[model samples]
Target: MERIAVSALRKTFTLKPGQTVTVDGVTSDRIAVLDGVDLTIDSGEFITVVGPSGSGKSVLLDVIAGLTEATSGVARIDGIEVSKPQTRTAYVFQQYALFPWRTALQNVEYALEVRGVATAERRDKARHFLHLFGLKGFEDRFPSQLSGGMQQRVAIARALSTDPQVLLMDEPFAALDAQTRDILQSELLRIWEQIKTTVVFVTHSIDEAIYLADRVVVMTARPASIKEIVAIDLPRPRDLDIRNSAAFNAYRGRVWESLRDEVGKAQRDWALASSYAN
Candidate 1:
């Protein structure tokens, strides 16, 4: 079933006078970051979005999450137009975004607390998710006491504790070391298999995008639109070793090929804008 739908979506930002920004090969008083973008994400689907910097990949996620409104078109969740944050949706960003004073368990319970869940029930749910994310013994530790990976794990645990119908992640693991990132990737896949929640993850890494997605959505440069949607046919229960497989490499190449020109274009646009600023 189509759990989320975006149709002819357009988002424009009006720049202050003398604040010049270039988008879609044009420099103007207003810029359209997302232009006529359309996409449909099914229930329980894992979709990864990839594109060059400033290509509105994050904007698309924001629109779908109801953090930003479209200047035109609409984004719908379960057939209802999304104008504000949906109760059944959860968002996890690159930052841990956990309270420094809160313990791991308390951080996870925050979401449930906001929803008015009973104190005892919320505590149990938080503990279950934290343990599932491998933070079992660290439950009492504050964010400052944990490593970067542990912090992110707690963030993910908190997001999942709500048992969200849709999970919107914006490079949630981007800050971790390569090794830690790999470990969390495997762990995430394992957890996803059991809960099967709909996920829309945005990342800059082609490998990460391909590895985590059922289909990878590649967007064009500024005035971003869907350039391509690459289906990942690789088997699930995927391990880190699969990255070394020939098929995985092939998929990587295809995604990079589609993204290469857009990246170049984005860079060129940035350079041009800088020159003009000077």
Candidate 2:
């Protein structure tokens, strides 16, 4: 079954003096940054969206998460049109977005608190998730007390605590060091394998996309549209070794080759905008 269905999705923002549609029109914008985009995802599928910065990768994730309202078009989760934020869908942002003052367990419990889950029950559930992330001993640690990767683990635990059916992540690993990011990527895959939730992940890293997703959705520069959707049929339980494989490099090359033009366009746009700002 389709977990997400987007149709004629369009989003526009008018700068104070200029009215512009950042995304014009397309069939699916599930990973399209511009207006009028359309796309669909089946249940339990892991899909990664990759493109140069400003290609609207993050915007597309936001649209699916209902964080950004589309000027026109439809984004539906489980066949219901998404008009507002729904708990069935969860978003894990790049910043980790955790409370520095809260302990890791408390951070995960926050969502349950808002949902009014009883104290005892929420604590039990939060503990389960924290332990699943190898954070059992650090449940009492605050965000400031943990490393970058640990903090992101807590963030993931908190997002999963709600038992969301669809997970929308925006560059959740971009802030970590290379080794840390690699570790978390494996952990994320383990969790996904167990939970089998539908995931829409956004990133600019080619290797990351190749490492994690079952399919990679490549997008164009601003007014972003789906340039191509390439399948990564690599065998799972994938690890660092997969990165050195011929199959991995072959797929990586295809994704990069398809994105080369869009990356150039984004760079040109940045240059022009920088000149105008000065």
Q: Estimated TM-score per prediction?
A: 0.96, 0.93
TM-score of 2: 0.93
For candidate 2, give the lDDT of residue 278. 73
Q: Write the per-residue lDDT of candidate 1 for residues 1-278, one digit (tens) a residue.
A: 98999999999998888886655566678888998999999999999999999999888889999999899999999999999998889999898899998999999999999999999999999999988987889999999999999999999999999889999999898899999999998899999999999999999999999898899999999889999999999998898889999999999999999999999999998898789877
Give each model's clash number: 0, 14
Global Cα RMSD, each model: 1.5, 4.0
lDDT (Cα) of model 2: 0.87
Note the Cα lDDT for every prediction shown. Answer: 0.93, 0.87
Candidate 2 runs further than 4 Å off:
17-33
